[model samples]
Target: MFPIRDHNPSGRTPFVTYALIAINMLVFLGYWGQFSAPGLDQFFYTWGLVPEQILSGRGGLTLITHMFLHGGWMHLLGNMLFLWIFGDNMEDAFGHLRYLGFYILCGLAAAALQIAGDPTSNGPMVGASGAIAGVLGGYLLLFPRAKVDVLLIFIVFFRIFAIQAWIVLGIWFGLQLMNGLGATQDGVAYLAHVGGFVAGAVLTFPALMRRGGVQFWRQTHGQPPHPQAKYRLAPSHIPRVPRK
Candidate 1:
């Protein structure tokens, strides 16, 4: 299942979130399909976070640069979609600058954990999944009861369900931990995701306390502090067909 949107819209325009999406898109386009397989691997080695390179006291910049790189189209799209769905409310709560800082910090924490988990591995890690996992972490802490519409695909069947934020995020966090434990050269940085998520929640705790902690949840009923958005599906105009 994937979250498509949230009921709680930001009170103001989320400039930082929009800028992040645009930047990721533009950066992907800069290198998309422009290199051969060998060249692409070389590029990732240079820009992506490699545990060995980092431990060797080199390629320091990859920690930050890797967050902007993606392995493929699906990788980029999935991360961007999560960011778009959950990022606005975070930006609204933390404001632009703090939110950006939180994002980067989460990414750093993710990289650190991944490196610590397998320092000997030479594989390059790419994509914003780790950082986006941080956003999910913060979102869960602040708005556990907020309604999120998730799209569930079951083979040929598909459906949308409006689930509470806590349930969705809780399950996601659990999956990361479960997968991280059994992980063996799977090429997915489940540990990084776990680290990013925990860091996001921890960093967001201060803001939560300032808002009155449990009292804050009481005040807003564990939802966005501002008014929640209501949506209605438009009726389709396609003519119905009758079968004999």
Candidate 2:
């Protein structure tokens, strides 16, 4: 199951989140389909975070650039979707500038951990998953009881369920940790995700303290500080076919 939306609504427009989505999209469009497989590999090597390159004391700028370079459309879409779902609330909490800074710091922490995980590996890591994972982390801390609508698919059957944020993010973080430990040539930077998530939570701690820590949870009931958004899922119009 994956989340499609959250009930927590920001008090104001999340300009930074929207700008991040747009920037990622535009950067993807700028280079997508413009290169052959080899050329794409070259491009990623140049812009994506390659642990070996950093270890060699070069390609230092990629720590920031790699957050905008996605491996494909699905990669870009998935990351952006998570950001869209969880980012606005964070932007509201941290404000626009602080949120942006938090995002970058998370990305940097992700890169550092990925490099630490496998310093000699030559694979080029690309995507905003790491940074967005940070958003999820912060969201979990501030709004654990917030309702998130997740779409679950099993074979040909599908359903949507509104579940608590902690359950969803907890399961996600667990999976990343499990996969990271058992991973071998999986091509996923699971460690980066883990690192980003941890960084996000740590970075958001001060805000939690400012709000009175555990008392904040008590006051807000671990939900958004304002009224939660309500959604009604419209029934599908398609008629079911009768079995022969």
Candidate 3:
């Protein structure tokens, strides 16, 4: 199950988040025509992340540039989905400038941790997962108790529930850690995820404090600024068949 959307939205404008989505989509489409298995492998190797290059201080700038690249459709789709889910609220809270800065910083911090973990490897790391992880991080801080909708599919059963942001984000983080430990060499960059999450959380501390700290929860009643979305299921239409 994953988040389709959140019930809570920020009180301010979220232009940065919208702009980010647009940029990532545009960039992906720009390079999508070259998505071949072997070609992508080479592209990711050259632009994704190469530990040897980073450690040697050559092509180190790729740490930042790589965040904007994707290996394939699923990679890009998943990252963009998460960004769409959690980014707007963070941008609302931090505004365009600060949110944008926060995003880049998280990406940098993510790269820093990955490099620190394996300074001798030569694998290229890419994708916006790190920065998007930061968005999830910031979301946890600003809306720990906010309502997050998650879709659950069991066999033919489908359902959705509004759970606390803490639970969803916390579980997501734990999964990353578990995956990171199991097979970081496989190119998931769990280190980057952990690093970005930590950075986003720490970075949002000041803003949380400024909002009257824990007291803000009491004031906002643990709800988002806007109303929850009302999802309507269209009437099901199933045609009957008869056999002679």
Candidate 4:
């Protein structure tokens, strides 16, 4: 199950989040026609993170640039969705410019870890998953108890239930760390997730401490400054047998 929405809405417009989403979409579309395996490989090799290129003191900016690139439509969509969902509040907390810096730096840290994890591998790493993972990290630290709307689908068996952000993101992070350990060379770079997450948490310290340290959670009590969303179920056509 994954989250479809959230209860906490941002007090101000998430301009950076929207812009990032649009930019990612446009970039992905710009290269959609070049999705052939060979072309895609070349594209990533040129723009994606190359430990050799980085270690050689060249193409260092790719760690940040690659955050804007994506592997496919689904990859772009998934990253943008998560960024949109949690970015606003964090951006609000850190302000637009600072939030942007945090995001990029976390992505940079993510690439660094991946490179250190496998410096010789020629695989080209792309996508904002690592950076968005950073956002998840910030959200977890800032709003551990906040309510997040998660859709629990059970293949036409179970129902959907809105759970807390802690649960949703926490489970995701746990999986990332676990998978990072269990499968490092599987090409997913779960280590990036772990790295980005740690970076978000560490970097967000100033803001969190400024807001009265641990008391910030006590003050906000793990809720966004918006009204909670109500969930509605789809209409079913099952017939009732008069309680038989």
What overall lDDT goes with each candidate model?
0.90, 0.91, 0.82, 0.82
lDDT of 3 by residue, 1-244 (tens): 8787777656766778778778878888987887754576676777776778877778866877888888778898889889988888888788789889999999998888877877787777888998889888988887887777788788997777778889999999999888876765565889889999999999998988999888987887656646755556422344779897
Model 4 per-residue lDDT tens digits across residues 110-204: 88887887787677788899988989899888888777766657778654556788889989999999998786566687988889998998888
Weakest lDDT window of 10 consecutive positions for candidate 1: 231-240
State the displacement of the C-alpha of residue 143, model 4, in Å, after optimal TM-score superposition.
Answer: 0.8
The CA lDDT at 116 in model 3 is 85
Indicate the worst ten consecutive residues by lDDT in candidate 2: 231-240
**Judged by lDDT, which candidate is best?**
2
Return the TM-score for each candidate structure: 0.92, 0.93, 0.87, 0.89
Which pairs clash in the backbone of model 4? Answer: none
- Measured with C-alpha atoms, the lDDT of residue 181 in candidate 3 is 69
Given candidate 3, what's the lDDT at residue 53? 87
Best by TM-score: 2
Which segments of candidate 2 are over 4 A away from where they belong? 35-37, 234-244
How far residue 76's Cα lies from its native spot in candidate 1, in Å, is 0.5
RMSD of 2: 4.2
Candidate 2, residues 49-122, lDDT tens digits: the string is 99999999999999999999997888999999999999999999999999999999999998888899899988
- Give lDDT tens digits, candidate 1, residues 93-145: 89999999999999999999999999998989998889989999999999999
How does model 2 fare in lDDT?
0.91
